[model samples]
Target: MSSKMQRPVCLLIWLFLLEAQAFEIPINGNSEFAEYSDLVELAPDKLPFVQENGRHQRSLPEESGEETDTVDPVTLYSYKVQSTITSRVATTTIQSKLVNNSPLPQSVVFDVQIPKGAFISNFTMTVNGMTFTSSIKEKTVGRALYSQARAKGKTAGWVRSRTLDMENFNTEVNIPPGAKVQFELHYQEVKWRKLGSYEHKIHLQPGKLAKHLEVNVWIIEPQGMRFLHVPDTFEGHFQGVPVISKGQQKAHVSFKPTVAQQRKCPNCTETAVNGELVVMYDVNREEKAGELEVFNGYFVHFFAPENLDPIPKNILFVIDVSGSMWGIKMKQTVEAMKTILDDLRTDDQFSVVDFNHNVRTWRNDLVSATKTQIADAKRYIEKIQPSGGTNINEALLRAIFILNEASNMGLLNPDSVSLIILVSDGDPTVAAMGEMTAGLDNLSINHFFPYL
Candidate 1:
């Protein structure tokens, strides 16, 4: 052979040998595990993937993603979960069935990641809930395991979520190939009033080959609350009660108990204790709100309310600048007030009373809008800082006096509507909502009015 041709052939052979040596995948019989094919050449124990483009591309110490995407070798794994919850206490039981359907002898390791808020009460597992052994351990975050590979290095642990009043529990076990295993986990946790979604993860280690992952989750929310703001879905029953799920999701089960008054008086009577009036009053709200106008052709007009004679021309904003109103509340309140101020007309009069420990009026009397006064008032509101305790009663009483005095002076017309905007997160320490009722006599109040 020519020297040049021989040299070229030698170079090609060398390149092929280096490539084959660098990347190696273990095949188990006929079924080539897709997971094994996807793995990178890192520390065998580490089980990190080789990326073609990212920072870990062809690197020895590879970055492992938070969770692996391989199905557990134990094919017939079943999860049975039952939950019991009250206003205070929550209990959950999970029974897992894992069957080793793989050929040949293999030692399997199991691991589970539980949610944070849960307090583990019982964790037990057996081949058929009869006889089996397992070890359960709790480690902080990251732990290391050894593997056979060119690069042997440590990797950071999985990143768990950071939330208050949350926790986790796990159990580890090893099973020989062709054997079946069962795991039962029981836990009790403190129930939270807030509604949201919670997620938990389960991981299985098929040592040196690939890792398997599973996700379990629980959704917690006041079921009917989501329907509150949505229109035409619910009707208000007796005493402003929300009529949830008429015939769907909620079962229709109601029985009116027989009473002496109901049996005796079967007709209309206006007396308070009369049986006839009681029945009528009990069902009046639902009947009125739930009735289909025009044979279900017309949608319910929930926004309908008795309109006051005069439209409100003067509005007094009584704001609470308590410490709790620091971040989102302060920022949102300021933005809302600016929008309210912009809506005021030339004929409309406005004033702001800010209260924390003590009441402070931004302006002594109702300031009529002129070009400059409105601008100055906007600037003044922008600089108000939120701090201290709430004094809603004092601020409300002072606002009533302001409105009364303005009306007496003929500055505020009796024919014009008066509105007092009270914005606060809580009731006062010294004076409560009942104490402030008398002061709200002449003001027309509405909340979540959907003005837009």
Candidate 2:
């Protein structure tokens, strides 16, 4: 026989064996293998195979029993964030909607991140027109209930976890096919003061979101808005600048993505507001004390009482030298302290108190912040190193004693702005004077500052 004829004969024998094996099925009556028959029957239509007649042929098997349906996954549809800022605090609300695009019901999880130090409350979920609401509970009780629900395999409730600079919360809820679920979260955060401006940051990066995303912020400053500045990154992404009211005491800012804006890269996501939305407003620093600014029948009074002599200030800085502050944290602290010392006025008297397991002070008493004294303070801060455990109680007590002695010497007058800036990364591990509880009580009763 020729070699070509032998090759065809071998191929034919192989094909026969494959066909025989393909038709052999196990008849052990195992229900688990019942689904296998469906896949086998779908081979002709799903597989890419040629027929013997030199034509491409495909056919689906006829229904022998009930037909199975396919389901789609749930997806986020839209997200909105709204903020209202007053003189002291800012209230933010987030609303999101999720849609189940499947033919079968689904249980979906929704997660959100909020800024650190922001108090989150008033969480509500709406499914099928029925609303479920939750409130802030004690940590212990909330944890117990959350655990109980999970152990029972219940698809409900939520959990919160705190990260370095933010708190993340997640919740799970079931939704019917083709139905939409809505969630609302509310939180309040104190406005940050830097230099001469009050700032608020709204984080907008949740994930790849729908086309209808928007953020609206309204700020009402009783001190009267002197200037409002928005970063350049928000040039075309947002609109409606700080529109001051007729009285110039209230302002409104709105940010909405431009759907028709051209993208720099064709494949990149559209120019959505993916970063923090920073809103800064400069207050009228020259306003005299007892000056009133009214808007919409609401009145705000300033109480700085200008025309009097500028009060001398006595400042004390309590710094932490614990193990956790060994690297970047310590470096940043030292740099900030240097800048702060440089900014002190000549009339200001200041002292520095640093602690690890033992307390240390730069000077036994308050010293005027002269050019030489400020330079020396900076040098002392630079030479300090991070080590040992945190002694919060001892360090705070030493600060209090210094302030008291300065007051006894008539350095801290009635009109002076005596301030104590406590900087620490961890709780107290060693308390020399007493336990942490008693120390806190004493500090709270004896030490009170309008701003800390």
Candidate 3:
């Protein structure tokens, strides 16, 4: 690499890393676990490929009036990602620079599949010498603005969509021939600790190789990180190793695979960088009270108790059988239920509540998930027919009522974990949904432990 080619990208990476900031919320921990409120959604974790030169694939006329025989090549000028984790809250940013190869206007698409729980906070595009930044607005208004920008050949991004284990969002910009465009996307998420470890999973699928590509991660765990390992099993095949440096409470991991290593084969220029780079670690913990850390007006509690017997679960399922879920949605729900019922433990008690305009239960109360009961549950799930409108609030309340009644009657073990899993098409009002969930949680807890 020449000094002549180094200044801009290096400066950009330096500035971007310095700008990556998050609320310093750290999770203190011990081996065993304590949890948040009663209700817990288990931790799940891991982009689409960037499409450049897709429309410009055809041979283009050269400056000398000769037609280039091969497809127009896309130039990925630079690629960089920086992740800064304070305690367990992480701020991540991805930056890429691409150059338009031909002397004609072309569309460059930037898409990435991010962790499902992470929310994109910022996105910007620098085209030629002009820069455009994203802003939050009402959906209708945002769409109208995006349309205007698209018409004016400006750049803007919107939306994150949920996928199996990841959600994706994309943005595209029209660049003039010889235009150099730089795209940056930033997001934030809290690292979750599950089964005694916290995972910092980064999804990587560049689809092609670039001259400069790197991922840098810095982590600070005040309770102290007990262990940190870079797992290469994020995807099928590829080497995803990082250089690790460590101190008592801080660690740095950098991965900068060379172009030779990024190639599919020694003689091939095709990229082999298509997999996740997983960093898994756990923090120090206390046997009692877990660990707590406070700094800069914010705090986080890391609690996972160690060596406790597994608590049996009283699990309740809330499924949507509304008109909108009439086809593929309902079909997938039934299929998922079929698999889940098959996995229930013998000591676990479970029931299902399916709702549309009205709510209905598969059983009068929770029952031990015996083979017979599991089989019956699967049958009931398959028979569910989608109709009418959705009743998300009432359905949640009804499910909670059943669990509380069962607990109060001694049918459910007070020592067991009570859980409600809702599978719905979608909620129209997010705020109301949150309120109802909070209210039902309080109701269930108060009913279960009336003296408290």
Candidate 4:
């Protein structure tokens, strides 16, 4: 091409670039941004670029039903976040990059929902001197932090920005063709009392960011509080997060509780010979009802109610020392066992079975509830460490066998009633109960206990 032709092409490209820059970066002169600057102090590092011309605004794409939910075309984009706890102060920043591809001019507006606990303290442009400070005269929904400060009430929480100004708040940028603008924000959060592990989600209202722009969440717990469990540790991606040691405050983890009884029984009227016996300690109150007692056969039950006399019950523990039950489970179990030992009366007889693939008996024979026997049981329980797969049924059968053998030897008092408490985290793997079994036939008699 001739030099003259090349010069014209170069000039055209430079003009397009200049136009894009002019629209993408704008100077804000508005009250909304001013009001945001008042309550919260602005930091220069956290400010976002303002949209000067219509070129920087994002237009909503029309979606077929197959694409996703419907959205407005001119909503542009917005960043919003709020704190839930009134006692804690929180701030959230939203950032996005807008790109213009169409030839026609476009603009976007962002809407944000402020949580009850927080308020905007500062709003400013990082690159330019566009300042928007909240006017003390303007009324807002929640009691403002500054207002609380003046009243000298517990000045913990703050208010937040409700709406993002499109044309004025520096959100509206004119995008001609193939132009883009980056919007960034930095939010500050302060809390009164350290909030426990909680969640705050931030995302562009559907029409805003690109279809693939993911919602990112970064949770920061109070100094002493720790995250006990999370559905997924990876950031938006399904990967585990690094495990960190917890502080003094314990983390709360949730797990589904096993149902103690089947609320609806298929064979309601039918009775089985091997009656069901539920003997639990530290169990939920609703489980205490002896629905299994209705079987009306030989069944013995013993329960350590929240407040009950610790007498007449002799317990033999068959604990699974498999590889699985370790760490917190083992530690908690041992602590509870110590408490149980303290509750035992001098006359109460007790024995211990520490089983993995095989059994290790604390006592060769059933031991009387003498102080010496109780101490020995405690020591044995303390020494138990998980090491193998759980054979719950095997452990129970062995425990029961030992109890029966003791009864025959005139060691266990048949009238006093005896219990074999099975503690296991895993279900039965090998050795299970046969098709038929008999014992505790008299509902007025003995008890069976199983703790999961």
TM-score of each: 0.34, 0.64, 0.68, 0.32
**Cα miss at 1, model 3 (Å)?**
45
Candidate 3 residue-wise lDDT at 290: 74
TM-score: which candidate is best?
A: 3
Q: After superposition, how far is residue 153 of candidate 2 from its true place, in Å?
A: 3.6
For candidate 3, give the lDDT of residue 229: 86
* Model 4 spans > 4 angstroms off: 1-311, 433-436, 440-452
lDDT of 1 at 313: 83
Runs of candidate 3 with Cα error greater than 4 angstroms are 1-70, 144-166, 234-236, 245-247, 264-270, 309-313, 321-335, 342-347, 354-361, 379-419, 426-452
**Candidate number with greatest lDDT:** 3
- Return the candidate ranking by lDDT, descending: 3, 2, 1, 4
If both were scored by TM-score, which would come out higher, candidate 2 or candidate 3?
3
Tell me the tens digit of each residue's lDDT in model 1 across 190-265.
Answer: 4332223222222222122212221122222222112211122112111222122221111111111122221223
lDDT by residue (tens digit), candidate 3, 319-433:
8788888777777778877887888888899998888888899996999999999998898889888988877778788888888788778887667788888787566332244
Candidate 4 per-residue lDDT, tens place, 382-407, comes to 88878866666566666677767777
Clashes of each: 6, 1, 14, 48
Which pairs of residues have clashing backbones in candidate 1? 45-147, 115-167, 116-166, 116-167, 117-166, 117-167
